[model samples]
Target: MIIDLARFVEKERPYWQELEKALDEIRARLLDLSDLKQSRRVLGLFQRACSDLARVGQANAEPELRNYLETLVARGYSEIHSSQTYVRRFRPLHWFLRTLPRTFRRQMWAFNLSVALTLIGMLVGGILLVADPDGRQVALAPFPHVAHQTPSQRVADEETANNDKQKMLEERKSSFSAQLMANNIGVSIKAMAFGLTWGIGTALLLFYNGVILGAVCLDYMLDGQTVFLLGWLLPHGSFEIPAILIGGQAGFVLARALIGWGTRDGMRTRLRMIVPDLATLIGGVALMLVWAGIIEAFFSQYHAPVLPYWLKITFGSIELVILVAFYWYCGRKTGPEEEAEQ
Candidate 1:
């Protein structure tokens, strides 16, 4: 049977056009080809284009039609074969702005639960301190100097005069910042690693952190320095807290995989599946903690009292807003590939 080359070209032109459009969108960064649906479509289109190129050759189609099919197939092939990861294009910035938020949003349930657990610990610690002042020592165990003395007593002591305090703070600023950064990183790494224990360690860490914070707040409140403490903690804690919570969420992801006992997928397979999201969470937490360390060491202590209390609080609030906006709105826009995937 003689093949109707002219009729075939006419019929398949739409498919060729679709393939070209898909390629254009993907190359232009309008589409996210990572979504399974969109990725499948792209592959299918590329295959069809390849088949059409072969058909044109077999039919001995006119030069114009053959060249058109050849070009379409070439473009589709290049795009489909090239690296498709979001990181392949924009690198770190892309991961931070788009991938981090997307991963966080996907694991919001774990995050919310972590937050709830932390809040409970804070409340319990605060209530215990109020109910029995002796419990303050337990709550403030993490802070040696502040644990034994009231904030007022510490402020008024001869050895800890304002000038001496300022001098000591200024001298230790760099070391303190480094220490804080190291501690934050340690906490995050532990929170992620402890998922091997089925999340018990992570949960305990979150609670302990909250209790520490609550006890510190109680210390300041009893000394009538609530505003002062807020100024000190809010600036860095705004970022630090979220980073820690994200770590907790990451741990939960691993814990979930480990507990996949009844599921069709084995624990190891589940672990591999969540590797991308876990990496993103851990990386984002590290970046946030770095920023927190800077603010805590250099800015928070200096500005907490120098700036008006209201202004400091406002700045912290603004930072919190920025964090929320970054996670909620960043990378929400769908490119052509993403839209097709949906």
Candidate 2:
């Protein structure tokens, strides 16, 4: 029996070990049974164990047994701990939010490109607006039309501007915190979606936004309203532009992932690996949008002529610092995990 057991262990170690454990337990139980019955039960148990060991040995002798073992091990691990199962259960949106900053950081090149492009767009737009024949009309379109002017009319106009500003402030007070978050998230999603079109769509989206900004700046410059434009745009553009650039970065990442999907191991395998990265990118965009909305709703409407430039500069600088720090922290946190996975 000892020799047979040794042979079974050599031929089928996994099955032999399991059978040995069961036999040990049966041996312990048999101590309580009558001698005849214990002998009969021991024989039956030995026969069953031998059958199990033979079945496993035959299976292992088949071609591709290594592959089969790997599959079995993976399946067993998945059944026990279910790491892959848990990842599957994970909601994309939730993952997108959680990993957003890391995704944005990974796409820093694209973000920088978007920033440069946005600045160029603003410059070009400003020039176009300045050269436009109806520059004043275009710039002041946000205001209402009125032909005649009186002392009372001027006061009324001033009051209306104050009222608009106040209303904007109230709205900001109510929703400023959430707006930036929502806007950042939306922009990131848009970037990712556009990336599906092979990044051309993303480029166009960036260009269109750039053109709009440039036209607005040009209009202000042409009207000799440089100071006004600077005051208005500086407060919010500081945060907003960076947020948008981050969005562009997300788009670039998505495009890159999509393009690289099938050139190596095939699409399914690549996508499984990249799912986490994709989530990170989406989260980054969401964060940017939230910041953008806050700036737009709260800081953009400040029209005080006497507001200090230093104050604006200081606040903007601080916000930029915070944003940079956030990305840095996220990078440190997720970078190693991603690298290890790679």
Candidate 3:
């Protein structure tokens, strides 16, 4: 049964034209990969062309037909590969400035949940400290080293504890940023790691930290040191708090990947899909912690003579607003390309 090659070619020519049109549209940016409908259409066309190319090969097709199909397939391959290459090249920058915030916005539900746990812990700790008298001990128990002292006393005790004031000052001056950054990074790592325990570890860690923060606030308020504490917290916490929340969000994402929710793929396959997002979140958290460490070490700790407490709070507030605005609007475009295609 000899097939009519000329008749088959005539029938398939329209399909080849369609494949070429899809490729051209993609290359010209007329078709957006971000739009699911358009992407599926383009993908389907590519797959169909691949199958046609195989069929043409099997048919001992004319040299002209074979060459055309090969060229079409190559063009499609290049378009796909080049787009991926572009993404790989720009991923770090794109993820940081645009994808991170977009992802953060998407995961606000989880972030809010984490914040709720923290706030609840803070509320409980504050209540215990003010109402129970022994609440200080209970609230501080989570932080073993600081458990012996209230927040109001901790700063003064640290300053006076060392008889070698000069040596203490030297040590702090050299290692302050490093120490603060290490601690913050450690917390983020813990949050992400403990997320594997079905987010229980992450929640508990956040709650515990919140309790400590609340106890400190309560102690300071009771001692009429509210101004001092605000000066201490506001400068670095504006960034640190958000970073911690993002960390918890990463943990939650990991838990979802583990639980096999919203995906039919295997655990490892699902994990691969989300690894890039996790990296972006953790990377942004790292940058925030670095900024926080700088503020905590150099700016927040300076005293009234060098920098007034009110001035510190004012500047910190300004910085906080700038960071918030950056996340809210950065990398977001308002063009037709941004819209989802029907």
Candidate 4:
């Protein structure tokens, strides 16, 4: 090893510099080493540098060379592995705005599957309601408020319940919002937690929710209250529905860990892998439901004049568009930027 210390240093310098650059890029958020290729390459570079450092030490090489190698190898180890789990003080704002979106994109397959299943459930519910009028009773049974009355009847009652309405709104909005948040969050948690059943329970719960949603919409549409239904549901449903679906996404993620189809990792390893993702998804869902619950209690409950259908519908549409943009584009790095990191 001591025979050609100068040549060894020259040969290893490029690799050490490359590893340092990769570390810098990661710190700058330009690259992600969660990818197999990047991790492998980085790990290779780190190991090589470590070997070089050991050889330098054995040969009693220059102190500066040994120290440089030591530092480079340590930084490589930290950055390469840190891609999976950042070790720092918790920053709520950064985690919510950045980490959460990146995690969602990383696990998009589960979310897309969740959406597809819910859509199928909605289609099935709509068809069942149209084919057999007798099934209407069973379909809407879960929501007695809608099940017991025609859409027109409920609309008229809500629009005309003007006796001390402001007083009632002032009194009930806070508590109502709280109740809605608690109930919706409970449902979402159950959706995620039920993944312990190998995703079957999560799927069933999502399907049931989709069925209820579809049935309620069809009931209102058939009864000629489409505007009223949109005014009431869209404002909150836009956020609430997607939030619930994300909960289901988290559940499927849990289920995937249990199944471990593609990866060769063991059960504990697989489970550990998705644990952070589950936490992120569930946390994001909680934030969404908080907004949804507020809208549902204050704005969605009031009919035209107090809160016009057009305004509520427009507001909800805007929220939906922003939400779609958030999940689709937020925290995403461009191909070139990511390449530069590598």
Candidate 5:
């Protein structure tokens, strides 16, 4: 079998070079064969290398060429057998901006359920509070500040408190921030943890939150404090409320994992699968709460004189819209990942 050495080398050189480039990229963690097209391409190249190696041996091709192909084939074999998992350095920005949103979108059904439950609770609480004004004691018992004083009176007290109220607010801001963060974080975690109860506990927690929120808002609205309500709550409430809902979303994800909704995987397997998602959600919620906490203590507490209601409302509205867009579009695959699978 007379092999045309020059012709064979020319024909196979491109494939060999291509395989080498792929291997390098994989080593540097620049390319991922998790994409089916890429994976098949690598696999095909590996087979071709094996076939070429056999021909090289039979034809007694130059030892230098044979050694190069051998090394290339070996690299491809290791990669194909067990794709290297290049652990990325933990990046807070990437996690917050990309991973969190991606995970949120993946578990959006659960998030929708959470929002629905909260809305229902809000409606129920609002109706009850409006229908039975005497039930303020029972309905608003959880919030003594709003419950004890009329909305107008509370507004008066907050707006009038302190010599140079700005200085007073700044002075106590740290303590207030810590307290708010602690309280909100506690509530959010409890909501997520309640997923152990097949989501019933989670649903009830969100609902209770909604009820309190609804009652407070309705009381303010009825007392003709809608502007004050929006100005005060909108700033921090925008981030704080959604953070809690995401917490509830995380709970529902856990509940689905526990219940094994559509998947046939075992309970442990299912739970194990969602560990990353749970962590991402909890982390995202914590960050949002931190922002809310700071805003609540420093910014939300201010009234018309200190921070204009329009400015505050606009800021909060911007934050809410950005948050919504982030979840809807961030980290979505629209590139070659959308290419037809191999």
Candidate 6:
């Protein structure tokens, strides 16, 4: 029946129109099939019929054709009742994966903008880190008192020196691993949340973050801590930055949706249809956070000098590969039709 509907919609406008009318009749009949035992079967048929009608409507641009298609949809929706079974046996995760690219395609502009901002943040941060001796202080200006001291001044005060040394050693211990993970997760969330202010908040957050990173790198370089810095930052930064980027991407999506709602008359309806995409983006961000937390807490803080630099590089490369793979899978071109099939 689905195949026939597909063929009709593709090849014959008249049959497509007839199929929509037939679906309306089926939908009305299903509504009257209110017996609880038969609800699932009837609801399934109703949903399939409605979906077929929508496909037919979308494949054609004729006003009359669209009007007829919409009438069938309205008729089907009118008959839906609270007693009808809405649940299906299909796995949500499977459907989410199948539809992800289609969702991403619809928000491609937002996605691209977020990515550009993230890269700018990283680049600015890296350059500042390499060039400025007091970059950390500038980056961390929002914090009180911590950035005031020069590296020499900071290292000279016995009390502060001892405290910092102790803190560093404690961080090296496995027990302090959770703190690192928590810190990274908090940073990512903040970056994402800041994006809601029309990307202004995001820009500021990224700039400040970049400054702090730059300052830290500068301090390390000045102190001849290159090897130690590389060992500490590389493992986790690989996953951490990309995760933050993904969060920024999500923020961009929300901003775009809001803009669309304001500018287009029927945008809310379209947004409702794409709610699943927003859910998927949120899910992806959550997954990235979990991965970042795990890496920071366990692998990055390990003090074992015996762990080869090559191994660290390899792991970092693997993380990048995973990030790329996820984007590719979720942005593939054939996603929409495949999702409808599923």
Per-model clash counts, in order, read 7, 17, 0, 0, 0, 3
Question: Candidate 5's error at 194, in angstroms?
Answer: 1.1
The candidate, 3 or 6, that scores higher on TM-score is 3
lDDT of 2: 0.57
Off by over 4 Å in 3: 1-87, 141-167, 260-270, 334-342
The residue-by-residue lDDT of candidate 6 on 1-342, one tens digit each, is 123444555665554455455445555553344466454654565576567566655665456656766765565565555333332234567545645545555666766766665556656765664566655555557544436755444334522345565567556655455565566667656665665675677666655555566556666566775555566567777767656665566566655555564456465765565455566665655566666667766666543343555576667777778766766675465557555755
The CA root-mean-square deviation of candidate 4, after full C-alpha superposition on the true structure, stands at 9.2
Tens-digit lDDT string for candidate 4 (1-342) = 464987887788899888888889877877677678987887898889888888988999889988888888788877765644354447798677777898898999999988988887887778777888766777888888888888999998888887687688879899999999999999999999999899999999999887877888888998999999888988999999999999999999999999987999999999988998999999999999999999999888888767888998999899999998998887776456445745
* Candidate 5 Cα deviation (angstroms), residue 312: 1.0
* CA shift of 57, model 4, Å: 30
| Model 6 lowest lDDT segment of ten | 81-90
TM-score: model 5 vs. ground truth: 0.72
lDDT comparing candidate 4 with the true structure: 0.87
Compared with the true structure, what per-residue lDDT tens digits does model 3 show for residues 84-113?
A: 435334556756777788877776667788
Candidate number with greatest lDDT: 5
- Mark the regions of model 4 whose C-alpha exceeds 4 Å error after superposition: 1-86, 334-342
Candidate achieving higher TM-score, 1 or 6: 1
TM-score of each: 0.70, 0.57, 0.67, 0.73, 0.72, 0.57
Displacement of residue 46 (Cα, Å) in model 5 is: 23
| lDDT score, candidate 2, position 105 | 61
Tens digits of per-residue lDDT for model 2 on 210-326? 766777665545446555556566666766666666667666666766778336766566667656666665555555566666665666555444355456556666777876776
Give the higher-lDDT candidate: 5 or 6. 5
Model 5 CA deviation exceeding 4 Å by range: 1-86, 164-168, 333-342
**Candidate 1 per-residue C-alpha lDDT over 1-342 given as tens digits, one digit per residue, 9 for 90 to 100:** 336977887788888888888889988878777889998988898898888778778877688978988888888777777645532655787788888999999989889978987998888888878887578877877788888777876644622347777789889988899999999988899999997899999899888888887778876887898777777678888999999999999998888888884469976788888888898999999999998998888877764335666777777788899999999999998779767756
